[model samples]
Structure formats: C-alpha cells, structure tokens
Target: MSETRIVGLRTERGWTQERLAEVSGVTVRTVQRLEAGNDVSLDTLSRLAGALEVPLRDLVAERAERDDTGNAGSTDDIDDTGGPAAGDDAAARHFADAARSAWRDIALGVALLVTSPAPVVLLIAGADAGLVPTSVEVAIAIGLGALLAIALVATLHLVRASGRLSPFLPIRQERVRFGARALRWAERLEGVHRRQRTRATAVACAMWVSSPLPLIVVALIEPGRGQGLWIAAATAVLLVVVAAGAFTALRTAWAPYVQAKLAPAVEARATV
Candidate 1:
C-alpha cells in the first residue's frame, strides 16, 4: 500500500494535508511523500514531529496506542482509516483532487470574473451600443452585475485562501496536542462556526434596527436621489446577511464531509 501505518492512523483521526502543513510548516508535498513511505530524512522527521508537537517515535510508531475513545470497535468499524466517514471514497477523493488543483481553479475563476466586465463594455461600444431604449433596465443591470462581480471575485479569492490555509487546519482529535499529526483538517468546525454565527446574528440585528441612517445622509446630500441611495445601501446590507448566513449554513452542513476528509490526518498526528 502507498500509505504507511502513520498515514492510516492519521486518517483514522481525520486531518488534511494542509492542516498538517500548518502545524508543521512543512511543504504539502513533503507530507504527501512521507505519508507514502517510511523513508523520510531524519531531519525532516524531527521537524515534522516538532511541528506536530510530538516525539519522533510517536510519528513512526508501528501500532495503535490504547483506544481512549473506548468504542470497543476496531478502526474499520468506526470509519475506514482510508477516509472520512461522511462520504464514500469517491467524494473524499474529489475534494482532495480539488485541493491539489486549487491554484489553477482560482486562477481560472478569477480570469472569468475579471473578463466578465467585457460583455457590458461590448454592449456599450458595439452595434447595439446606441440602444438607450430604457435607462432603468440598464441601470438595474449595472447595479446587479457590479454586485455579482464583486461577490464572485471575493468568493474566488476566499477559495484560494482556504486552499492555501488548509494544511494546518485541525481535525477532531482526542486532544489538540502540541505534537499530534492531524490527518483531519478540523474537528470542531461546527462549534467554532456556531459561535461566529451567533456573533454575526447579533451584529446583523443591530444593523437592521438602525437601517435608515444612510437615508438621512443621502437625503441631506441630495433630496431627489436620497431614496435610491438608501435603497442601494439597504440592498448591500441584505446581501451581506445572505452571504454570511449562507456560508455559515454550509460550514455547519458540509462539516461532515470536510471533517471526514481530514480525520485520518488528525488521528495520525495524535499518535505520531
């Protein structure tokens, strides 16, 4: 098998390569190669253990330590040391592949969003450029398109950042030791996410309660266009809520699949 005992142990716990990288600051590729074999350089192994905050022997140990979970089941029964329990290997493999290709995906996504503005420019400068039949439609499209573009660009950037930061994300370990070899990325993502959501909910409620101050500002500046400005500002606020709420929901829901992927890595680290 390509994977070593350490890899299997790590998978049983759940952790992503990215998380391991973060805790260890080793290159993702190094994690990849080491997991594949027992032949890593001593210097690399020492650093990896140090980053995982564990002893070198813990990482290279050949057996599972006592089951603190006390579940009375072998590793296979709880979940395959092969992958996260939430999905079949195919699904886990998919995200792993995506993570590997993250830079390319982000690059493509950005290129598309950046060039999206071209269509509007074409409409304005081409044969149909002179069609000013309804200013309102053009204006509305402009507002929505701009907002959509902003959202897309922001989303793509976020994807790239997450991919890069994933190496060291924590997985569900018995404990977050100074030296665990997290095979999984995050164990308590849902709990962490819930706390953040609560805070956001409070902030949103506060903003909603004080919603009209922008109108006052615009009205003071320009009586006629004040309502439009206020409406736009309100739309922006609503967008923020929707986006934040949606991300929170996904974080909680997809927690299983994501956590599953990294679980082995985390478990591996715990022992290593």
Candidate 2:
C-alpha cells in the first residue's frame, strides 16, 4: 500500500480524520500527522486498524515497504501538500445528491399543505355570491369534502417524502462523518446556496406580506359589486402566492440548513 492509503480508506468509508480519531481513541492531530506521512507509534497504527476494521498490517504496509527500500522520499508517499484522495469527491457527490432530494421532498410537501384550502375557499365564496349554480348548503358540503381530500393527499405526500429522506436524517446519519475536502466542498456549496436562499426568502416574505393587497384593492375599487366573488378570488390568489413563496424559500434554503446542522457535529469531533 502507498503512504496515503490510510487517508483513502478513511475517506472511502466517509470517515473524517476526527471521526477516525474518535473511533480509534486517538487525537485528530495524530490522524492528520499519520496521513501526512509522518511517523507514529505502533500502538496508534493498531488502534487505527481496529477502528477501521482492517488488519494491522494494512496500516503498516507503507512503513514496511519504506524500511525495506530505505526510501524516505518515495514518489508514492503522500506529503502535506498532496491533493485529497479520490474518495473525497465521491463522498461529496453523495452528500450533495442526498441534500437535493431532501429539499425537493420538503418543499413539495409543504407547498401542498399550504395550498390545500384554496379551492374550498373559492367554492364557498362563489356559492355565496350566486356565481355558482349550487345552493350554499351543497357548496359547503362540497367544500368540506374537497378540504378533507386535499388534506389527506397532503398528508400522504409528506409521509412519502419523509420515508425517502429517512436515511439522511440527523439520527440516522449520526455516525457518518466527512473529511476536510468534503467539508470544504460543503462550505463552498453553502455559500452559493446561501445567496439563493436569502433572495428566495426575501421574495417569499414580500409576496406573503403583499398577498392581502388584492382584497384591499378590489374592495376599494367597488365595495358591493360582486364583492363575494372578488373576495373569494383574492383569497385563492393569496393562498397560491404564499404557497409558491414558501416552497421557493424552503427549497433554496435546505442545502444550507443541512450543512449548518452538521457543523456542530464536526466541531464536536474536532474537540474530541
């Protein structure tokens, strides 16, 4: 094995240096020094191997090879300046994909919940204004039925999305850890997403705060002319705009939110 194989193994398993340190009962600096191709004790090597569930020889192979060749500067040896191992990229991609899925599910489910009452509100208002042929009592019944149906659908949607996101939840991913390369990647992605999320949230808030404008505008223009129908239309529009805004904000913010939530875990691991 090459000198950087320890880094390879740890990263391939999605274990950060700090994670390895915690599991192996060593310091994070020790893990870092070892990966930098610095010499460490046999006991440390044994602990690492055990923590990684690999044989001790796997951890010592590079040292053995170097001793045999009396080569301290072999080309295969990794120095502090070496680039990250291949596993880092794969881990980062996996994390990105997972976060994307989680956000999509969350946004869609909440959007459904938010907009579920729009149709019912419109139907009742239309009936009250004689805009619909149905009697007010029948319209109320239909609206109630529609409300129940939409609520049920929203519940199912949320449950299904939650199922799909279960693996990425904090409790399930508690033991999973990220390396420095992955953390840097996450930070960069978070920075880009933070801007998007902030913009989305601002837009959403503006939409929500302005949603009542339609009703006010219509009432001021003509107080009694088709007032019921106009009020219903305005309410329906408000629900839709608010739902859209919420979905946009949630979708854009999910990546940053997830990354922030994981920060404390990394910090704890480092201090360990």
TM-score for each model: 0.32, 0.63
lDDT of each: 0.46, 0.67
Cα lDDT of model 1 by residue, 60-90, tens digit? 3442232434523233212224322222233
Estimate the TM-score for candidate 2: 0.63
Q: Which prediction has the highest lDDT against the true structure?
A: 2
Clashes of each: 51, 0
Cα displacement (Å) at residue 227, model 2: 1.0
RMSD (Å) per prediction:
13.0, 12.4
- For candidate 2, list the clashing residue pairs, or say none: none
